[model samples]
Every structure is written in structure tokens, then in C-alpha cells.
Target: MPERPILVFDVNETLLDLDALRPAFDRIFDDPGAMRLWFANLVTYSEALTLSGAYVPFTDIGGAVLRMLAATRDITISDADGAELTERFGSMPPHPEVPAALRRLRDHGFRLFTLTNNTLEVSERQLERAGVIDLFERRFSVETVRRHKPAPEVYQGVAAALEADPGDICMIACHVWDTIGAAAAGWQSALILREGNAPLDVGPQPDYIGQDLDAVADRLIERYGGRGPDRGRTMPPLLD
Candidate 1:
């Protein structure tokens, strides 16, 4: 059997339950659906900033997006409201199956890591709060490259840091744009069909697609488990 590829996970909605922030949104925007809009805009702007050669911290962009959204509806967001959103975002609980699924992947000898748009500090706080921080061997942030996902440079930077061939890495994310970016970088990809996400037809597609982390974990273990030698090896340091 071919050596199993290293698995690199995406944080945010892929592992953590983004819905945990709904209450904050409902209270602040007076519209629960506004959460989705805010998140969508946050992501859109992150990419836009990267494409335009401007970089901003993801959390700052999120805050800016929130204020922008509030302005659109002529609503007011106070300092406390912004703080509450930040707190909720940082403390989002892992999806119901996330912890176990991650453990299972590790048990199957997969080397797990994270590459997120959030800064390393925020991603650490988030995974630590989610109680799954230990599952990852390392967490990478786009801040290191000052670029965001769907930017080939972001994916390439991870591969360069790991000293691994792009083909030896698999990117697992709920966002199709993320998967597409990794695939373009010659990495394998898996897409978890989180709510408001689905497979896209007109692009490089993910190698695996599942309803959630559990389903994706099962598929990975089935495909890559029990190989003759352990291919899921320890990773090198991100910096020399």
C-alpha cells in the first residue's frame, strides 16, 4: 500500500461548531441569519484582502465585518457586543463528533496538523477551548505568510515548512475554496459538507466528501489505514 498522506485540518466551521456564535449574533443583530452573512462577508473580505496584497488579522477583519453588517441594517453594536462575539468565537465548542473523530485519526497513525486563516494565537486559543488542541501536531496560520486561503501561497507555505512533497499532504476543510486551493497546490483534499457548504462542480474537486468529521475520518482510516509501514510520520519544525 502507498504511504498514508499527512492530514492537515482546517479550523473554524470544519471542526468547531460555528452555530455556537448564533446567540451572540441574534442578540446583537436581532437576526439569527445575520451570523451567516457576517461569516460569509468575513471570508470574502479575507480573500479580497489577500488578492489585493493587503493583509489584516482574521479576527480584526471579523470585527470590521461585524461593524459593517451592523451599519448596513442601521443597527448599533457596542463594545460589549464586539467583545462577546470575540469571546464566543474563541470558545466555540467542537462539533459533536470532532474530538472522537480526531482521536480516531491519530489512533490510525495519521499525523494531524492545522492550517487556518486565524492567527496562531487565536487558533491556539480556539482549539484549546474546544478541548482538542492536543490532537494537532502543529497549528499554522496565514499570518505567517500574510495571505489567506484559496491563495496558492498559503498552501505552498505549509508544504515548504513541512519539508514534504505537496502530494504527501491532504487538506481537510468544509470550504470548497479551501479544498480547491490545496488541490491546486498538488495536495489531496477532503471536504466535509457542513451546513451552507457543498461540493462545487466547475473546479478541481476534493478527493473525499462526507457529511461531517466522523464520516470523513472513517473514509480516511479505511483508505489509508494498515499500510505496511507508518507513513504518517512526525513533522519538522515550521521554522529553521
Candidate 2:
């Protein structure tokens, strides 16, 4: 059997709760759904910039997308409003089960890391605020490679940094596009079906799917826990 894979995670919406920013969206756009729209547009434009051979910082893209969204409704956003949005984004909390699930995976002997489109500074603040920063061995930002998620280069960059083969990593993320990219890079992947995300029927797909990090952790432990360097022993029960 193959050795257990190192776990590489996506931060936003995968580990952290994006809904934490909804209040800012509601106040800024006066629309309950504006946060989702702004996020979708942020991803879209980020990918567009990457594909077109232009690179912009993720936070800058986020701010630009917020402005674009505001313009759509002829709503004016002040500098203070933009700053508040940025602050809120960086302080999102982990999903309720994320901390324990992450600790469980670490306890099972799976090395953990993070790869995010957010800049290292932003991601550091995010995970630190969420109280799980200590769980990750390393955190990678696509900013280092001047690319974004769903880009093969970004995935490859992570493998290169870790000095591991792509096949040695298993990416866990909430977005299908992310898993698709990791799969293309020859990494196994698990998709967490966060409320707003669902698996796609076409193209490369994740090897596993679960409704939450806890569920995904269970699957990972079942499949690979006994296959780590200290092999052939039954895994311990998951943490409560």
C-alpha cells in the first residue's frame, strides 16, 4: 500500500468560516447575498488576472472586487469601509469542527500544511486568530509563485517547497476547483462540501468528499492512518 500522504489544506472557506464576513457585506451592500457575490467575483477576477499573465495581490483583488460590486449597485464604499472589510476577512473564525479535526489528523501522524491564495501575512493573521495556526507545519501562499488556486503552477510550487513529489501530498479543500488543480498536479485530494460548495461532475475530481472537516478526517484516518512510517498498527480513536 502507498504511504500516508502529507496533508495540504486550503484556508479560506475550507478551514475558516467565510460567513463571518457576512455582517460587513450586509452593512456595506445592504444585501444579504452580497458577500457571496463579492467572493465569486474576487475568485473570477483573480483567475482572470492569472490566466491573462497579470498578477495582483489577493487582498488588492479582494478590494477591487468589493469596489466593483459596490459600483454595480451604485453604492459608495469609503476607505474606512474597505479597511473594515479587509480586517474582517483576516479575522474569520475556523468552522466549529475544524480545530479538533485538524488536531486529530495531526495526532494520526499525518503532517499538515496549508496553501492559500491569500498572502502569507493575511493567512498567518487568519489562522492565528482562529487559534489553529500552531497545527500547521508550514503555510504556503500562491503570492510567492505569482499565481492563484486552480493553477497547476501554484500546486507544483507547494510540492517544490516541501521538496516532496506531488503524489506525496493530499490536498483537502472545500472548493472543487482547488481539488481539481491538485489532482492535475498528481496529488490526491479530499473535498469538504462546505455549505456553498458541491462536487462537479466533469474534469479531475477529488479522491474523497465529506460534509465537513471532521468527516474528511475520519476518511483520511481510515484510509491511511495505519500506513504511515510507523506502519501496520491500528489507529487510535479520533479525538472528541
Candidate 1 overall Cα lDDT vs. reference? 0.92
Q: Give candidate 1 regions above 4 Å deviation.
A: 227-240
Worst 10 residues of 1 by lDDT: 227-236
lDDT of 2 by residue, 164-188 (tens): 9999999999998899999999999
Q: Where is the poorest 10-residue window by lDDT in model 2? A: 226-235
Model 1 per-residue lDDT tens digits across residues 1-240: 667899999999999999999998988878868999999999999999999999999999999999999999999889999888899999999999999998878877889999999999999999999999999999999999899998999999999999999999999999999999999999999999999899999999999999999999888888876633334453456843
